[model samples]
Target: MQNPKMLIVEDCPAQQLFAGQLLKQLKIQHISYASDGELALELLKQQRADVMLIDLEMPQMNGVELLRSIAKQQLCQAVIITSAKDPLLLNAVATMAEADGLQVLGSLAKPLNKELLSLCLSRRKAEVWPADFERKAPAFDQKLLRKAISEQLFSLCYQPIADMNSGQIIAVEALARWSQPELGMVRPDVFIAAAEQWGLINELTLLLLEQALQQLQQWHDLGVVVQLSFNLSPLSLSDVAFMQQLQHKVQQAGIKPELICFEVTETQDFTQLSAAIEALANLRLAGFGIAIDDYGTGFANAQQLSRIPATRLKLDRSLTDGVSERPQQRLVLENTIQLAHKLGLTLIAEGVEKLADAMVIKRCGINLVQGYLYHKPLTANDCTAVLCNSSEQQAAS
Candidate 1:
């Protein structure tokens, strides 16, 4: 890996000088500067920069437009938005850039100092650059998805959720896995998005739900009482008939609804808010737990939170990755935990990959922790073995 070439797009001469001085001090060799978005566009067209530092407020074409152009032309691999106007506005612009398919490293307040610049530069260095900026997934159609579902090509894996105080595995979350015969192991993110687009999410969700419930039933027969959590598609919540079917299936499985939790991702858009709420309420009334998944990484607002009768809030990985090391992240996590507790919701911290982070989460009063620190998602047999071993340990103790 050679030295990264950086481009600074700032209209203010003073700010440009400041950034240049810092870059030089940091021993950065190749550097470029653009007075405005127009100049930046021209410079980008001529040469490629590994990372770009952009000022939001600019004459001619603004930073937002520059980001659009960068994404359109596949110019820069990463971007950092620096603005003095308003932090909220800058963050919005950064979100827009991300939506446009640009990797937004982060946002920075203007009058940037060496410390902040160094942090941004280090982050940029740590990023793994792809071979191509505009790499697209191979086209997958509805037919392929339906075939995969019908053939039972999808599988479920369980990730344990542990109690912070007892340090015991109390529950497990079911995650869907698919390996396309041709595509090898297709990522859940890729196939899931495709499933939603192709209107096959309900079918996929039901299949996984049935599989998870059946596995839970087997565990129950083995005398291992552990809760199971499974992701629920928002689209399924709008259909009353589907909800009835779900209830019927649970009854047939002879599994208590209380042992199962339906996790609704916060990123889902509830076009029919009333119907969704009614469905969730019905599920809760029927004894199933409702969890707001990926709490801080979505479009869900306070109003939405108040409306949904969620029993648990799962913190997103973005907030948990470095909570113990980063003060800002720790503060955010603490505040979120406090808010959840005030609302009478159990907080489950996700992405606890480090013991230090786990200690911080436990100290924050979050008892339910889930992430790779405990275990990765396991196959049904493996999960059952874990539960059996835990039961044996308890008996021996």
Candidate 2:
């Protein structure tokens, strides 16, 4: 993304000044500001902005509401959602924006730093947006999605999670690969939002689960017994029947529920998703590992940890990526590690890409790790090869 015209929607004067300085340092000159979302919308009514930097904590029409309004009115093309809130909240908001067809550069947690801002800006690809242009909806034929779910057409890619000390693969997280005819490969966030919108998310999740559980059983059959973890959307967990089917599917696969972990986010809406939350608790009680995914991203904290029945805590990549270099990040990571330990939750540090950071995480006592450092998400067959190869090497060592 180029240095296109940008608008900042925020209420805090000091934070606004701070953002201005960072933008200045980056030489982002074509800038404007609105004290609140309402004003921002009004200003954007006349002139369009290439990018909108939003502060989520604004008084009237908070950043999230602003994003909704922008998406509804076609107010902006790209946005950088900023907040003092946790990174999970930012990620959730970003997903929402993307689902609504807004091009999200990424999210930033304030107080903002120039390095991150520059990196996020570099991710922007320069594109000309006509004033009359509207954000494109997530394009997928409902029939196609329904067919894909029913036939189990969607594929799973496995990314290995390892015990850092022994350098042994202990688990693999299943990520969905959705490739549609003609449209080619769709972004996971985009397609997932589509699934929810079309009310096919439950089917989509079950199909993936069936495939993943079967794969895990195959690996176990071959004498490689490692756990399997996969994401579950809040919407997918709303129905008690889906949870029942999930358990039945595991039993039918001849896989022990203990070897399976279901990962869920700190969902967007807490009020309406009480049943889904309860479903997760019940899943935990049923001998399935329930992981509070993305622990340090700002949402899962001391308060949330004590309440949820999570057996595992997977640190978000955002919280661990630069922990070795940044004092503040290290501070947060260290504290989170202690909290999870005191609560007796299994710990896994995600995004352990660097030797320095990996050493830091290892020293911090996070034995389970996942990231590109070990392996990227690969097809089941390819991943099987990688896992077998890893086993051979570990045995030799």
In order, candidate lDDTs are 0.82, 0.82
Task: List the lowest-lDDT window of 10 residues for candidate 1.
Answer: 124-133
For candidate 2, lDDT tens digit of each residue in 24-100? 88999988999998999999999999888899999878999999899878878788888888776777787678667
TM-score for each model: 0.78, 0.67
Worst 10 residues of 2 by lDDT: 127-136
Tens digit per residue, CA lDDT, model 1, 289-328: 9999887775654555788999989887667765665566
The whole-model C-alpha lDDT of candidate 2 against the native structure comes to 0.82
TM-score, structure 1 vs. true: 0.78
Question: RMSD (Cα, Å) of candidate 2?
Answer: 7.0
